[model samples]
Target: MTYRVFSRATVLGTAALLMLGHLPQAHADNAEDLITRGRYIADASDCSACHTVKGGRPFAGGMAFKLPTGSIYSSNITPDPAHGIGGWSEAEFSRAVREGTRQNGASLYPAMPFPSYARMSDSDIHALYAYFMKGVQPVAEAPPASDIPWPLSMRWPMSLWRAAFAPSVPSAQKDVTRPFPDPAIARGAYLVEGPGHCGACHSPRGVALQEKALSGSGGPLFLSGGAPIDGFVPTSLRQDQRTGLASWSEDDIVAFLSTGRNRKGEAFGGMTDAISHGTQHLSQEDLHAMARYLLSLDPGHPTATAWHYDPAAAAALQRGDTTAQGAKLYVDHCAACHRTDGRGYAPAFPPLAGNPVVMSDKPDSLVHVVQSGAALPGMAKAPSAFVMPAYGRMLSTQQIADVVTFIRGAWGNNASPVDAATVAGLEKSAPRPVLQDKPAPLN
Candidate 1:
């Protein structure tokens, strides 16, 4: 009887040991999955756009931000024990990301976009922490210090700004129990409002330069239209007939996000960075969801007439009519690439006719493009690069204005005329053309 009892006890002990071994493996797998999710979140948030320096290590943080006040540099976020967030706990990291507060209690500049990140879910925060801690390569590089001036540069004032403009932490946290009217819309909302932070560029700003609309529900200004970034205006995401995406179907948006081009135009300037780093890697489902949410916005305008081809202008141009200086300028300077009809070579030279950039009320983009020229973002799908040569040296201010005016007014694009003064102003402020760099890897 004693021998039999000893054998049973040994078997039970072995089974318990086996279960204990399996538990650790299960936990490790779960942890890996969380890290994977966190990687996705980081991509969606476009953390690399600011954090990573061009031609430098990813997330090692030497990117320069030229604000109206002064230039500031991004911070290193690698898991390096000395330089990165290797020493940070999950709570410290979360506070830094969500509350814009560093572990040492210094306030972060709004350029970090913690205002939008504050809305992220706790689960996502945990997952992000896991990815940063475990999956990322540790880099021991420190970024350059910011160049912001005193009084304004003081971090304490930002705390007061946060108290007034930023949302409370408890309210912003995502609740799984909360039901969205549609799952796609819910996902899109999460992306745009939190990770995507579309409003950071697209939405109009108040006196304090705070985004007037944080989300779609905030007001019509949410993605309706706003200021220009790096010379390219963020066109209205709303459904306006002229300046917005009313003519574009949901598929068009998805296509644009994925490949950086559709019937309208290709991505250039700041948008190129966004597409290259953030949107291109997103799944088709997420792209569609984003399209759906953007389409749902009420732009406070009824759909009017769709822009169509007018043969009259084309015929007149063919006849060599120099009656309109703008028309004369276009035929002389622009027609070869843009074509006589303003319908440019597709997926290469973008068409100006019926294009949102041409139709925008503000001529900043058109003026800047004409002055400084532009290089379309090179993509894997579209391997060949296309460049719009700078006319700043060749063309006079009035001539530049005239050519843009012709494009804007031609082919049923009834945007307001751009004057030489506007062109002059843009020429003074426009960024100098730089040698185009190869597209950076999304990883």
Candidate 2:
């Protein structure tokens, strides 16, 4: 099979270049200034999403990544100087940030999303390095090791992967950058494409987990939404009325991205994670820009065909003998607020009739949701919803699968049926829910 380069491939190689001997000579710039800039860059770039462990020290790496090759764990990026990147030269830090290479010779797993960071300007990388070394508090927690099996974990292969796919350039405007009515929107585009790397999740991945487009290249819909992430279908940010954000205003966009809450509804599923760890820390300008750029998309639906669920199968959900088993489960468990119609409270429960999470082919998401009951903010807010309790403790794997499948396929919905076995697996895979610092508004 032919393999192609992903946005990240280029990112890793380019980040590598940043490390090529450009050590931070004792510059006259004040340490505080460097730390401040680094903190901004880190926040803007969402470094913690990959580098930090949940419930652990800030910036201490231990996030587990499921790579095509094998599972990889993020290393601690702290300034411990021994276990972390502390003793590395400035160029080394830059390369790791911009490229995928580490201090001496180890190759970083592509899960690091360096391809996107590779485009970041050198100054930004320098600032980030300085912050880690001099500004921010480093934790003593050692990073958890990866679990890539046998030959696949053989680090040397990653070099070939880098050579075949990684880019060596930095983020700069091309000969042509698109016009934006709002400068904030323009800035958002830059952040999304360069540091934010939203496309890594919002955009579709090709054969080898490469982001289909970098900077959402083909159209405004680039990172707009309606793509499968993990197993859930993320809503598009574009201005399309139904599947896209057409109904949302600029302010709504800003609010949603920043606080994970808005008039349209609270952020849900994976989005909750993104906001809690990534977007929440972004500057008001960057958040506004991201919202602006996303809203500006021309109603591009990445998975139009995929988003369309199987109608015939869904019809069976409405009429089959099994329907009763599912319906009772839903009502007894779900109906109080979502309503029997499956049209959840607007912007709150998210009408299941068309909720992307319910319509996804990969039932892992729907199943996970039913069994685990969405961790704290994973249910979106501003409405402060989630009356649903943890079914993991209450319901059997089979019961969870039946109800979730019913939710996904009933009403006007049309999604693949979720098997009980799938639900069982999800029960084993997902992480335990945690309390958010502050809960989002429930509708």
Candidate 3:
């Protein structure tokens, strides 16, 4: 055997060459991992909800959002150079996403929810950019221009709106830090206030259309409740027993987020789209984190007591005594699906007895559901698309109001009674609920 001694310089050079040889493969693997992470981030951010039209290509845009100004269509976000962000530099993408400015320096309307997205970390933004640029299929489609009228449609005003209302990204990041001792809560806060942008629909807005509060520390207004969106009021996510998630356990919240239903209620309206495209795809760990953070909130109405189920209405109905004006309507129409006990089949027909939605301060959602009817959107965990059929065409406004009043008042529910006037008002405003492949915007 012949042994050859290698000099130190030769050994070092050979080792360097071996490492350099693997760099391309290593870089490729890293890029793939980043793209995968970006996909998850996009799902969490619910990028598809507003961007994709029903039965249309994902992120191809053309979803119409009816605003007070006029109807504005979502822009195509695919990688097509002509119509999408394919030509955008990472800095341009970051500016648009965080500061609500387009690549051309035109301001994006608040409907895009960039204020909430401003809280996203740099890493998450980077990953999202990588995924949109590398993983998403290019689509050569252009959406219609906004009919928002000239002065309102002018992008300059949006710059003023951002200056007056939008929080700085750094300040928003600081607000999500260590409010609670648990790191999980911190993570949850980041997800909710950042990528999730739950407040865009769930939190009340100011006269300027800015959300009243951005994070938990901002006040109880954050996720407390929101104005009617597409005829359904976004109920409070706070711990209010009557109208929020006070009674929901962490697991119950997780179940609702992942499966789109729990013992409490089923997802309807914009919530359906939110779950099918967003929360259902989240990891269990993240789901639990969100649940824990949500549950940590104090009751919006601190003096409110937990809702209890009363058998009085059920017993009265069983005895065939429909003394109340609305009682007869409830028995005739609602009793079949929502049983006499007011508890519908689990995960199918959601229980009305002591349901938060039924007892919400504003009965908009319940009234709208009764009038236009709602469909419980399907997902991987709950594949059944259960629908509450529209009664608007069949029932008079008064009759619809009466039945809604009955549902809200019966079974120990103490919400304010609905009136024919309220129902009449909604008749002119509320959109008929439709169960499409992709749900319309929640707000």
Candidate 4:
């Protein structure tokens, strides 16, 4: 504990930190093994779900993501020395994944979702590097051009956006000493928060498109579900009994993640893709781990339950004032298919009664569905899944909100009604997907 000894310890600590930053780019005991590990990590992170060629090899990179600012496609991240990251050094690859920096010194668009990937540990990062470099086929495909409008499409602005919104590094590990707490559960938490980047899609976004809160810190509002994408409602991960997964058990969660089905509901929305390509492939241990971690979240999280439906809602619906405009539309348009009871036919038409999405606090999914029906994501069980037909073209924002509100309140539900203003905002911002028809399923 002497001064000279203290100085030596401090010097050693600083040197260790410096060495990590200055380490050689992408060193691996076995480059091929490293690449294979990285491929698994990437899948755990669901990278291909967002970044990959439509019909080509898995990581060839051409998936297009639509945002309020513009449409951005996944970049060509293959190890092509000419068109891809063939020349990126180890530090550069880490920077792109961790810091959102491109090899050219430009910041990548937040569309890459590095904000969530930033939570990955150093060892995992190295493993990811190995996978991308060795395991992946070096695709020479050119990246599809983005259609971001003018100033919005500009990539430079994301530099400031990174500083303001992105987390600079990964999150610190939570307590790990607890025994019998399910190693897979901890791994699930790590994968979900860090590599999985589930929050990127499930968490609500701010004006800058940043995740509302990384770890459900603000409230259940964190992943209480987000705006609908490609026509499927984003299921709320909240612990609410009626509107959330109150009825689900630990095993139920596991079954849903692994098989994409549970007594609660079938995975039809974006979840179908998440399950079929993502979690279903994950080891049972990891799935159980994730379910445990999710269940371990602090229930009765600190947030006002402003969305609970009241008697006023019931009175309004009875008087034809509850989501008034929506009521007429439902009776006129939706009721025939969805039924006046709000319960659509069995498996063919998903029932709104006791459905978490229909009973959620947020109206994102409800509104989007009313405005833009579901899109064709390649699947076989139900060929040409019933498209909801875009009501956006025919109904005003208020009407859409009202109908959503009516459906939400129907059938012993307790969710609040949607306002026209909320509907109007999404209609102006959220883009409708243009899937012409279902693509052939992957072999």
lDDT by residue for model 4 over 192-299, one digit each (tens)? 777777777777788767888765444665566665566445665757666556566888888777655555555655666666567766777887888877776654
lDDT of 2 by residue, 1-443 (tens): 99976698788888877765343533434666788888888877777777777677877888877756567778888888667878889898877766788887778777777767767777888888888898757677787677777877777877777666566653334501567676776777778877887766766666665655566556554565534545456655565544566556777777777666654455656677677667777767777777777766776744454333334533443454344547778777777667666656755555566554455456666665566556435323233534335577778878887788777767756666777777766666664543433543431
Each model's lDDT comes to 0.82, 0.66, 0.88, 0.68
Cα TM-score per model: 0.92, 0.75, 0.96, 0.71
* By lDDT: ranked, best first: 3, 1, 4, 2
Better of 1 and 3 by TM-score: 3
In candidate 4, what residue range of length 10 has the lowest lDDT sum?
170-179
Task: State which candidate, 1 or 2, has the greater TM-score.
Answer: 1
CA deviation > 4 Å runs, candidate 3: 435-443
What tens-digit string does per-residue lDDT give for candidate 3 at 50-154?
Answer: 998888988999999999779999999999999999999999999899999999999999899999999999999999999999999999999998898888778
Most TM-score-accurate candidate: 3
Off by over 4 Å in 2: 1-31, 67-70, 171-182, 218-246, 268-270, 301-325, 341-353, 377-388, 396-398, 409-411, 414-443
Q: Model 3, poorest ten-residue lDDT window? A: 434-443
lDDT of 4 at 62: 81
What is the clash count for each candidate, in the order shown?
A: 0, 26, 0, 7
Root-mean-square deviation of every model: 2.9, 13.8, 2.6, 11.3
lDDT of 2: 0.66
